[model samples]
Target: MFLFEKAVTGSRKYWIWIVCLFAVIGAGFLAYLRQLQEGLGITGLSRDVTWGLYISQFTFLVGVAASAVMVVLPYYLHDFKAFAKVTILGEFLAISAVTMCALFIFVDMGQPTRVLNVLLHPTPNSMMFWDMLSLGGYLMLNAVIALTTLHAEQKGIAPPRWLKPIILLSIPWAISIHTVTAFLYAGLPGRSFWLTAIMAPRFLASAFASGPALLILLCMAIGRLTKSSGLREPVQKLAVIVTYAMILNVFFVLMELFTAFYSQIPEHMEHFHYLFAGLDGRTALVPWMWTSAILAVASLALLIPPGTRKNPKVLAAACGMVFLSLWIDKGLGLIVGGFVPSPLGAVTEYAPTLPEAAIALAIWAIGILMITVFYKIALAVRESLA
Candidate 1:
């Protein structure tokens, strides 16, 4: 709750990064203001493609936020000592990711003030309402758990026994956040591409892969900065988790392809076609999707083999590939693909304008800044303990 003492103190490079993040956030605010005044029309979103980059980011980050469970489950449930060191990092990452997810949702709303309506006029029947609830709850849950645990660690004492139940509750709460987000899309009747029971599972698999891959990179950087070898074991364990998750994620893609092509359902196959190839000569996203596939496969190549994965440089590259691949697959491809060939069979295309991209990038910068500050506080606490 009172962690700002450490957060306000950082190195020159850290301050520079924070300043850059602030600049980007400021620019994003300006862009958002333009959209706010002119309405969502300035965006690439059209009548058919209602959601764009903001929703896509929201969807992808929900997985990133949920991925925190990978670390939490092993540490708290199984009592894995290796993960005990970095569990705080994972929870803090979730806090930043969920914060971004909330911001994206807020930005996506044409009228930001209308967001309060979800709370004022609760709609239990709407998946969006459920998503809002889950995301909000998950954010609060992770913040409390992370803060309390860190506070206890700083005080050189165990977290209170009463906190254990709350910590345990976060395990399922994490899953629910992403599941509800998937349902927001999958439950839609006209959205054939998203209408699948496997959507949630696929979301989870990709989240597990991308989330831990990011954590691995962060752990490596933090280890170097802090001169702490404690992260080595946790990094290795997280790499294994990322490896299996990446494999499952790729398998899920295959399963989706098989379901679409094997059945030859026009509605289902159209989206895949639009994503991978061109639908009626509109192939804006074709190259991006293929590139994502290539990156994903290459990442697997580097990850599946233990020898390659053990090499830090190779592992870092592989982790980056996995993150980029999923970012494109889930963030760019999935959201945009679903809207192509809208329910009426019209092939309307959507691309983010400069203002839209700026706003999205701003949200990303904000998330990164939050992670930097939170991790700074966390590292300071660890240093004090040392």
Candidate 2:
């Protein structure tokens, strides 16, 4: 019943997937070695664009990790039966996502060995320290709750009564993780794009949408692969949650636009102009930004109609569209767009180098591998009970 032993006993297809992930991870490791030897010059980061793809990904994955609470709240606090079957899966997904967030931060630090300085020389005034604390604490909370719950289930015993309090604590902790992350950008003095009062709410709304959409897809895939029957109702319920969250996310985006353009402040307007239409002939991100907007609208159209949202195939596609749209909006667009015309009023463009991309791929591969192993163990336990 050991987790690793159970994980190694997965079917042929699972092992094949693991092998492919390892291959990508290996290549990335080699690329990281080169980066360590040569320093951060291997990345697309420049004096103007200091935070590149790594920070962007870290920001995105933090939202993904915090999304676990949507399921946890209804299942544990409200005692909702619809979320019963997949609560463990959500927690395990959070674990993998938080792991990715931590790894992305580690790799972004050119001197990986000096990461201890964040802890050793604690800066109480810095938001980065608070971010580290929130993510690390959330990771521990999820891991402990998930493993204990699974272990109790395998033994046909209820989880300890005392654990309920800790579960409740995680609800606010989940909100705090992304809120603190937004504060990291929002509090910056010169970053006009992220200085909005709504940044934290926007982050939470988008996280709720993207995180649950991903969970729905994963649930569907697991049910198909495992030949299970109970996921249909849960997946349908999740789709509704995703729809509402996506609506709020889109609303937040529009609110941001209205405030920026209506106010007509050159500092605030420039960031929006640069992201959507390009500034001074720097049109690199305009295409991607528009594509994200179009996809968001299309996905909303599909999600709003109860009939289409209830159809499994349609739901899946809409979930995918929403996920991709948010990834482009928050993942690629948000981080890079904030620095479009830099703080000093100079236009500079940044694109990830091959090695940087490889490293990012490796981190993602590692996260997927972790999820696979965790789910394998959970599935084996469930099958044994059945």
Candidate 3:
């Protein structure tokens, strides 16, 4: 009861942030309600561009949540003292991020209420069910593990000897959530572009890069605005990890393009054509496509220079660009682009309507708000313990 109460009564600033966050979310809620009343017709989704921004965000965030394991495995399993101070925060961030991912999907669905239909009447053959199961399981695992670890720390007791296995289990489970998410795209028999074996590896690489980039940016924000010492060494180490992951992400994308063009598969080439060339100027996603490329190159340039990576200002700029680049590349481009010139050879485009955008904005605001409130509680808890 004490712990529960403590969690609720956060600082005044925390409540202020919460109110602002909810104001944005409430606006989005009104927008989502409009969508629910009207139907998916309110958004830009047609038969061709079925999965739009919401689904794309769900995919990207799953990877972010999974990457929390990178911090956890090192600090907890391997006993890396460098990460000892910041790993708990990473765990909490993961929780908030995953919650947002779930909400985004809920809002995207045609029948938000019927979501239980997935469980009430399980589909043994559908990949969607497996995805729901994995995501739910992973969220529970992260929450339980993180809270138990924090509880142990507060009491100055070592984590339970047996909980180590659960932690170990979470590592692969983390990989599975994103893999299942990729499979959600890749498994569609008609979409030749996403049907490749390389999709899972590509997902892993991009997730690793984008996840750490966000963590680094978060650390920078903490250092600048607050009295926190910030995560210096661990942030640097994670940046190195991001660098390697970025290279792999670029390589996998190149390999995929090469394989498609080399194979001379007309079905495969069609998707790329829609993305790059634009089908009859009707499906012109050209601006987004080019912007993604430029951002990717710029991010790599900023990250590769040791001087730039270490400097707070430069690192923050690079991290921001990298984060946006991944959102455009994976969240918007990859998902929507794949469905263009869809199986029927008809070109369709997607642009979120005001309501859709509002709902999405609300969901994002809610996530930031949750992080702020939780962090306030965490800070107060730490000070009390000390």
Comparing 1 with 3 on lDDT, the higher-scoring candidate is: 1
By lDDT, who's the top model here?
Answer: 1
Model 3 lDDT per residue over 145-189, tens place: 877887787777888988888888988898898899888889888
Ten-residue stretch with the least lDDT total in model 2: 1-10
Question: Which residue pairs clash in candidate 2?
Answer: none
Q: What residue runs in model 3 are displaced by over 4 Å at the alpha carbon?
A: 1-14
- lDDT on C-alpha atoms for all candidate structures: 0.94, 0.93, 0.83
List ranges where model 1 is wrong by over 4 Å.
none
Candidate 3, after superposition: displacement of residue 167 in Å?
A: 1.2
lDDT per residue (tens digit) for residues 1-386 in model 1: 49798988788988898999999999999999999999988899999998989999999999999999999999999999999989999999999999999999998897788789999999899999999889989999999999999999999999999899998999999999989999998888899999988999999999999999999999999888777768888998999999999999999999999999999999999999999998999999999999999999999999999999999999999999999999999999999899998999999989999999999999999999999999999888988989
Per lDDT, what order, best first? 1, 2, 3
Against the true structure, what is each candidate's TM-score?
0.99, 0.99, 0.95
On the 0 to 100 scale, the lDDT of residue 13 in model 3 is 71
